[model samples]
Target: MTQPSRRSSQADPAPSPAKLARVRTVAQDAMRGARWWTLLDLERILRADTEFWRDLWAPSLAIAAHKVGLRNARSRLDEAIDAGFHQTDLFEPELSAAFGADPDWQRVIERARANVPVPALRLTAWPEPGPAAPLRLDRAEAHRVPQLLPRLPRPGEGAWETAKTLLGWTAGLWRHANARINAGDALDVLEQVANGARYSCVEYSIVLAQGLNALRVPARRVWLRRGDYHDGIGQGHAVAEAWIDDLDQWVLLDGQHGAYWADEHGKPLSLPELQARGHPARPVHVGARELMKDPALWAAYFAHASVSGIAWEPKGFVPVFQDGQVLATERLVRDSADAYPRLSDLAIGVTAIGGAPAVELKPVHPYAVAGSWNGETITVQGRQRFARVLDREPGEHRAALAAVTPYGPLASRELRWTAS
Candidate 1:
């Protein structure tokens, strides 16, 4: 294979007057729709916050015309992330917290410097469902993914908040179902839920993914193995990861604990990447964070990690997200194959020759679909691969794709189409 010559992320060319107007429009709409647009604490933070420029950032003022998004409207405030302003923790403003003896909350900046960084994926399309391929919406019996977004019980902005909202909304519902029995279709499980039946990790994962789909965010269930007999978390662990368009990366989220994984650098990570970081105290230090106000759920994450399972997906066979939820927490994949196969690098990557997208997915499954879009409109949809169009679409054609296994939709990846 030839070596990739292009940089992961490059300096963005100056936007034309028209494009600049579009940026202004995007910034405007974001402000109009933002939930954290105004708050008593935010007013104080922005006024006193020198984090960004002289401006309050734009979150409440404009994202603080900087954080990522608005989450939980009340005493329940998750850090509202202002995307463009502080794309990474590296750009975080000054922290007044006492250092050393006191927690240097500001250390987030130093840690970011020590971590290996990847280029933010470029996007040409709007971050929504049309750009990303549709999951098993047909399986929902009565409601499709879009149809349920308004009703999914989560209107929060942070990826972390959205995940827990789904889990809590379904509290006391999922009992247990055999993995293989319905390993492929999460929509069906969703369909059955109306009848007041129980669900498993698969159902939870499916709903989580579909809910993301409803919000127009690219998402999929990520599967992990608890290999090495860690804690016997069964065969593996499964969780949903959502692609945050502004950040240009996928954020791993678990509905059960309302948790997410983060590197020492403060960048959100996918489950595969998260599991890859566990080294028993090596060069890399990985950790998980919870959405709850209380820190109780944090320790549970490590205990949950002790379960026995594969660190990654097994060779030749791609595990579905449904079974992962149970295995990741319980430490065992239900009815897992007796022999543990070697781990495969199933990380998704794209291969572009000219200025076009060539998306390739690993552990290929039959029911899954991959697609690309020019903005929000569909440009091409593929059953197997990108045997479709030119990543050469005019302007920006964002890269997005998805697949629904017999069990449910696997995780989806969203990236910018840099080829054009």
Candidate 2:
């Protein structure tokens, strides 16, 4: 496939001297006594034209900031003043002076200060949720495969058997439970497996690797910070890619979810479908130390626990922000497993609770809830408030609710009336 055009790196004209002075001040404060420049701090100082900063100065600044050893340094706004970097407007005079003296840097700063492009507003209808398949991969099969996880195959042996094994495991689970096999059900099973276990994406990947190994499949963990389509933020995601003999190319699999790889319509997805969206794809290999230093990666990876099938690429890989400072440099991972659980599990539960009775519900997290039921409807609040009743009996009521204003439905539960 043809690569997308790279964003332009041409610098715009410098901002007014006064504005430049202000920017310099912020940069000085950000850089004073600090070892390096943080993408977040730079972003805050140059928030006016993020696109220009991202496209033109961001790359250079990212390198420079890291070189300066400011990635983990605390903000030095106060120290900038002590160091004569800050001016009357609490701006960095040194940075201003640097810009005035260095034509090249001046040009970059100018471009970085340019106006941002207003995104075009377009209205697209949200697609309807697809049907939920039963939990595939029975407990016994799940236990068996993990124990029998095959060794990493030889380079030329291919990953088809591994893929088939995963598929068979999931199919067995679904069939045993008499449940339909769909994307959502697959996620539920994975979530149960995770069970609040705190493991790095790599760790999770390792677990999956073990399972795949037991099944004699060659698999590797892929990781990266993915950009969001709706919001221009970067978060981490994980996926397993296995070599497939049939396709003769490595196919991406949601190891966190079940084996059946389907889109919203339940149609199977190819490798391309499982890749990242928007940005050029890069392989992710993170060590334990790096993962610990970057906790946002974990949060980012898990944020999409409720999304549908995978998108081809990340929306973008902007710097991660925390308390107005760029805490982490983010890149969009093409294959993310983190989004699977959130999107698939809660979505299916909400669908099951559709139109159920209202009850006295108390939500634990914005994503989960518990409540007492009444004779009519079951009421619950989580990501959103929901009520439903089964068709067979009035006492059989269910509700799904979200604590916070969610993009869609949240927690779901069903309860039947008991003799009082």
Candidate 3:
């Protein structure tokens, strides 16, 4: 993908908020969170071409809702039709049947999901994950990934193939990069490791997701933060999860462990459900331990799920944002295990880093950054000093970043910076 022509080196001076406000029109557009059909994005589409919106927009939403099994979706479509808002030519038959023609709603939804391209434009990264992550699966990779598919079983028969594939992904063709995460495009990092270079767990999670998406399988990276308490494992880790639309849920598939969570029925478990499980202390596979470079030799991590921090549908390595908060559709984030308070200073923004204004983390995450957030998202990790340009205005603005750390809630120091 072409990097936006707008360029900024690590050494460039942090543009003042005044200058940034002038460019907000551009930066904010690029920073939009996933494929969310926000007002601004809608305006862009409407301005780009109305017929595009008129023909594709409502129909796409209907298709998307049906795909995700969103409740009352077909009803909404029928409502649209009743109001003459939706053209009949644009109405999908399966969708129409789901509401009226077909008596079996479940069957209708399944059929719609099976036949349609995943309708991601209206979905968010969480609650219902979308397809537009920055780390992309382009046409080339999508076509190239099928060769790797058979190595893991198709996600059936209790996901045996899913287990093998997850293990294979974590164990195969990847070297752990000892450096900081590149922090932007998942594809860019995968390119580095395509010929067998090193990447972090975050990168591995993304690559696995990309491969699945290339095959037209829906998936997203799962952020697994080691809560304040642990078996002495690392602070955070990432893994990939696949969307079983038929099941209407996401299930964990950890490449690093060649493992996944399952219910008593031995079915795959979604991140939220897994977090809510009564997981006890468990053992981490030796290979998994090696991959993570954890200190506890017997693999204390596997014994039980870390409950303190489970930001289901969290943002990607290159974070996404809308409004002034992180990109999660669910505002209330809690891991059933840890009852400690959550932190509000959990975000970082494109502020000055060490007296230099830079979006990409230099000498750390080594990739050009794209995407914007007002202030709602995880701050750049790694032990770096960074700040965010405040809301463009003429007065003082209070900034807050919230995150859940192992020790408890993490709060950024109360910062009141004047915006003038």
lDDT of 2 by residue, 347-375 (tens): 21223344542233333222222232322
Off by over 4 Å in 2: 1-161, 167-204, 213-216, 224-226, 229-234, 260-271, 274-420
lDDT agreement of model 1 with the native: 0.40
Give the Å shift of residue 416 in candidate 2. 73
Could you tell me which 10 consecutive residues in candidate 3 have the lowest summed lDDT? 361-370
Identify the candidate with maximal lDDT.
3
* Local lDDT at 188 for model 1: 54
Residue-by-residue lDDT tens digits, candidate 1, 251-342: 65655444555566766665445544543211111213223443332323322232122222234323233333333332333222221211
By TM-score, the better pick of 1 and 2 is 1
- Per lDDT, what order, best first? 3, 1, 2
For each candidate in turn, the TM-score is: 0.33, 0.23, 0.33
Mind giving the per-residue lDDT tens digits that candidate 3 earns over 194-308? Answer: 6566766666676566555543444566555443322333645667766443343455666555456556666666665654545522323323333433334312333223221
In Å, residue 198's CA in model 2 sits off its true spot by 7.7
Question: Candidate 2: minimum summed lDDT over ten consecutive residues — where?
Answer: 282-291
